[model samples]
Structure formats: C-alpha cells, structure tokens
Target: MIAAVRPQADPPPEATRAPEAVLPQDVHATEAVRATEAAHAPGAAPATARRRPMVAHDLDGLPVPRAAYPLTRLPRNEPHASLDGARIVVSGGRGMGDLAAFPILYDIAARLGGAVGASLPAVDAGWAPVTRQVGISGKYVSPDIYLAIGISGTPQHLAGIDPHTRIVAINNDEQANIFNVAEAGVVAEWQVLLPALLNALDHPGDA
Candidate 1:
C-alpha cells in the first residue's frame, strides 16, 4: 500500500557575489548601510553568505527561483546499535494452545524483562495477536535472550530470531525440532513449567 518515492536531484549552488563598488566617502557609507540591510533580509543565509540572507538571482530585472536548505541527516555507522537496555524475547510455538494462556506468556515476558512473540501457526490460528507473530511473514526480533515455549522450530520461525541469540526451548516432546536450535531445553508442559518457572524466579537459590 506504500507508494514509491522518486529520487530528488541536488540543487544548484548560489551565484557568486559581485565585487563591491568603490565610491566617494559618503557614497561608500551609504553602500555599507545598504549591504547590511541586504544581509539581514528575511529567510535563510546562503552557503557563501554565512551572516547574511541570500539575495535572489536577478537576470535582466527578473528574479530566478529560490531554494531551501537541505537539512537532512546522513546515514550513521552504528545503524543497528541499541541505545536502550538489553532485550529478552519470549516466543510461543504450536504447543501454546488457543492462546488462552497468552496472559501467562505476557506475565513471564514482563518478569524476564522482555517482549512476547508467537510462531506462525499460533498467529494463523488466531491464538496470538498479529503484532506478536515471528517468522519470515512477521516481524524480525533480535533480543539478547530468546525463550521459546511449546514451539517446534521451523526455518520460517527461526528467520524472525537472530542466529547468534541465546535460545531456550520448553516442550514435552524431546525430539521436537525446536531442541535443535535451543541452547537449553526442558522436556515439560508449559502449563506445569510456567508455575515452576515463576516459583524459581520468586525464590532464587532455593532449588
């Protein structure tokens, strides 16, 4: 639904200033006053006329077109660098069920200082909101830690997450595809695992 933007050509430079006219003492003083008035004219100063507003180009009593300053920001080197704190991402797969448990996922994400995301199937099934979907067709997420629960790792789903990110998966099936990409795995159901996770977080060092 977006329209293509046409590239714009750079504007031409301003015409050079004419050499100052030499005149008698009184005439020279009057000319100086006129120059000051011209410099303080309304509008932006030209590149050459740092302290003065640029005079319009006059060709045979006719004025040429005027131009505005191109105040644009150039591309920076660290484009992907994050100015904010570290991010943690929690993504749910098909095992998350009808998304009736989304609140629990949101709560977990809040606890872990992260955002919530969902797999393609969960998004398609209307379990998770479209904004939270992760995959080629969804938004790409590059969080510091990626925790995937009840998910089967699909290439499409993995495309949304960074390859170098730390991944943790939770699923009952030990042979699930998600385990392949997970740095850590726990063979457990989310319904039970979530409570255990909450308890462990609440009571740290009390294993």
Candidate 2:
C-alpha cells in the first residue's frame, strides 16, 4: 500500500528577515546618551580649550610698577675721621643682656672718655645699634685700652680690635674663653667689677 503524501510549508518571510540586529545597549542611561550624541553628531566640532587672561591688581593702592618714580644714585661719601686721641674702647657682647648692665658700661665709657663698641651678636639682637658694632662685619677700632665686658672673644669680634691694644676682660666665670685672649682677666661679676672700677676712678688714691 502507498503512504499518504505530507504537505510542504515555506518559512514566514518576516521570520526570514535577518533577526533585527541587536542595537548596542545604552550603558550610561538617557541623559548621558543625549550628551554623547550631541557631542559626536554629524557636523559637530570639538570645542577649543580656552586660557584665562592674567588679571593685574594694584598693591594696597600703590602706584603701578611702570608708573613708580625712578630711584636716583647718590654720590658715595666717606665716613667721619676716627678720633686719634681716643684713650679707651669700651666694648660689650651678648652676655650683657641685663638691661641694668648698660648703665654701668655707659658710665664707665663716659668716665674713661672712650667710645662704646659692641660685638656682632649684640647688634644683631638689637641690644646695641648697628652704628656701635665693632666686629668683622662692623667698625675696626684701635685704641690704647680695649675693655671687654662679658665678651667671649669670638674671632669675628676680635677682628675689629687692635692686636697691640691692652685687652681687659671682666666676667664672673674664671674659665671664660675670653680670658684666653685678654691681657688682664678679672674673675669677678661685671655688675660688681663695674661699680668697684667706678669708685676707684672717682677716688684717686686707692690701693
């Protein structure tokens, strides 16, 4: 007996249409997509980065640099003549911080009729003015007597003093480094020594 024939059917045309290509997933969401699309759309060019211009501000209402007055160069001048007859050079150092000590030195210098000098530290610390500084970076002084009060005799301070001048250092400590360079070392407090010196000066015949 012959088998019954089965009917053949064609695939639906819509199904045959290449399965609609899967569109790329918008990973970022709508706003980002819109921004990206706006940035890279046809006929859209990348923006040029802009540089900000520098703004000038006047300094505390001061005039501008170009408008400021030009400084004039003054003629070089020499210092006044040193006193040749100056008998003594009374010098002080940083150790003399006690404000009370100043008057003693001042009085001693006045009595001896000598100029007052200062070490570099004293000047730098504002204890003494720069004008009175006697050191490597200050005035070089040569006098008959160099009385150093509490000075430790740093090389810089010694640089300004004359080598031939008789150096007298007064300090409370006997082992002070100043004693090494002093011709006469007095191991007594300057506060005590100064008054004693003043009294001796005032009284002529005293042992």
Candidate 3:
C-alpha cells in the first residue's frame, strides 16, 4: 500500500551581515575593530519556540468487536464435488424441461468419468444443487471438455468458463448462442437425444 506524507511549513530566514575590510599587517587592530562593531550592533531577540499541541486520538469506540457465532456441523451425505479439478464436465440447463432428466445426465457423466454441472436456471428450478452451478455467480470451471446440454450460452455463464476448454453444445434450438462458442453442436430434443446417448454409451459398436 502507498501512503502520502504532508508537506511541512518553511523555516524563518537567518540574520547575516557583510564583513569589513582589514589590513594584513594590522591583525590586532582588525580584532579590535570587529569587537567594537559587535558591541555597537543591535541585539536580536531570540525567536519564541512554538510547541505542537498534544493530539490525543482516542480509538476506544472506533472498532466494533465481532460477536462469536454459534457453529453447527451438518451431517455429511456424499463426497465433495468440485468443478475446478474436473477433466470433463457434463452440464444440464432449464431447456432440459424437468428435473427427471438429471438422472440420465448424471449417468452420462459417470460413464465418461466426469463431474455433473448445471446452469443457473437448472439449479434454481431444483434440477440440480447450488454447488453444481456454473456461471459468473457460481464456480469458475476450466475442464478439458465441457458438454452443454439444453443450455443457452449467456455471457455471464460463459465468463466462468475457460476459453481454452473445448465446448460441445446440444440444444433443441439450432440458432442457440451456445453454438457460437461451441466446437461442435447438435440440435435435438433431450428426451429423444438422452436415451440414444445412453444407448450409445451402453453399446459403442452398435451406435
């Protein structure tokens, strides 16, 4: 942190006089003349010293002590999931229609050895937990591959994603904003698309 110092007031000028010319051979005479001049010169009164006023800064009431809050431990249900370390992320959104499709989304992520994430609307609609939210208001993600299902790409949501991550967008709307940033896109309804994807995952050769 940088701090600024206040400028101080200038001091008063000192009293001075020109020296008298003295002969080189008359050193004692020159000393006598200088003594006479010093006796005749008017005496200057000593300047009165100014003392700075004592500044008593009382910080007694300035700070407010924080109150100790009661801590309660919640029951642990499952292992903690984080998006930052996830290599692949399969995310769902409001366009998936309902929370019923989350199981299929989760299954796809599990099969691919990835984490499950959700858009803000999907989390708000109770389709996924708040911890899985991905957006400017949620956790930032930089996974190797990001699969966006039924999610419209909003600037706020995209802001949380790393630009280097390969994006794959699947949406019913062909003209979705997600397509602009996605490396690959598929336009299809999730109801038909999800089951087909699961089937492909089950039987890779048959797909």
Candidate 4:
C-alpha cells in the first residue's frame, strides 16, 4: 500500500527578514543601560549621596626657613677665563720646558681672546693651575680651534678634547704623537713658534 504525504508550512515574514543592528547609542538611551554606565564612571557617587569638596592643606602646614646668620656679602673676585664652550683653546704640556713659557702661552691666548689649558703633567709639575688642566682626570674642552703646543697626544689627554675640534700642533720633535691627530703641524718648538705668532699678531700689516 502507498502512504499519503502532507505539505509543510512556510516561515513567518518577520523571521524571514534580517533584524536591524542595534547601535551603542540606541542601547544607552534605555534607562537601565544609562544607570549601569553611571555606576561604573570614575569617582562616581550614589544618586542619593551629597558630594563634599576637597581642599589641599600641605602648604598651610609647611615650615618656611628663616635666616640665622648675619647678612654680610662676601667680596667677589674678578672672573677668569672659563673652559666651558671655549671657541679657541691654547694648551701646553711638559714640553713647554719652563714655567716662564706659560706666561707667553697666556699672552698668546689673550691676544687671540681664547682660554689657556695645560696637560696633567704640566699642572702636576706646578707649571699651570689645576683649573687649567685638560685631560681625562681634568676639564673636558670642546673648542673650535685647539692650538696644542708641546702636548703629546696621549689617550688620557685626547679623551678630554672633543673629536670635532681642529688641532694645530707645535713641537720640536717632528715625530711627536701630537702630529698623528693634528690637522696642521709644525716641527718648530713653542719657544720659536709662539714668539713669531705673537709678533705676527702684534704687526698684522707685516708679512
């Protein structure tokens, strides 16, 4: 015997159509959603509670310093050449031979409106002041022009000089280590060279 078949019913029109996406703003418009958001906000207070203002009292309780000493101004000495940001540095070393040579170095530096610097040995030997010492253990200088007279290019001494500075070396020994790093070099000693330089500065008109 054959069996009888029945027809199936179709889905409703609402089920067949796609639902519209709900925006966050649309959800927030509901009273329940708005209340939940208010509960999570930073430093949020209950709707029934009254808020109290906060005040800072740290400065009000802080102690101020009072001067207990006499008000006598100390006598200020004249300012000397500062090594900081010097455009031109005329530096010397033990090869300067004598303390007398320092005065000439100073004169040359004064003529050139530059500062005077010395190597550690020169400073240690009392040839120059400790303030004028330029080396690894002393002041670091970055001058545009570094007139290195009688200085041997030691690692310690070279460490204090800026790599960008243009070095001009003057020494009696042609094979001196200074020449290795010097942009310009002279085989003459500082004694002979400095005097001529000063003379040239003194008489610019003369060749």
Tell me which of candidates 1 and 2 scores higher on lDDT. Answer: 1
Writing each residue's lDDT as its tens digit, candidate 4 over 32-110 gives 0011222212233422222122122121222212212121322124344677878889899999886766777776677
Model 2 accuracy (lDDT, Cα)? 0.50
Error of 2 at 182 (Å): 1.3
State residue 129's C-alpha deviation in candidate 2, in Å: 1.4
Q: Quantify all predictions' global Cα lDDT against the true fold.
A: 0.52, 0.50, 0.57, 0.57
**Which 10 consecutive positions of candidate 2 have the poorest summed lDDT?**
26-35
User: Model 3 over residues 113-133: C-alpha lDDT tens digits?
Assistant: 788899999999998898999
Q: lDDT at 163 for candidate 1?
A: 59
For candidate 1, the TM-score is: 0.56
Q: List the RMSD of every prediction in angstroms.
A: 30.2, 42.6, 37.1, 37.1
Cα-based TM-score, every candidate: 0.56, 0.56, 0.60, 0.61
Residue 162 CA error for candidate 4 (Å)?
A: 0.3
- Candidate 1, superposed: residue stretches over 4 Å from native: 1-86, 205-207
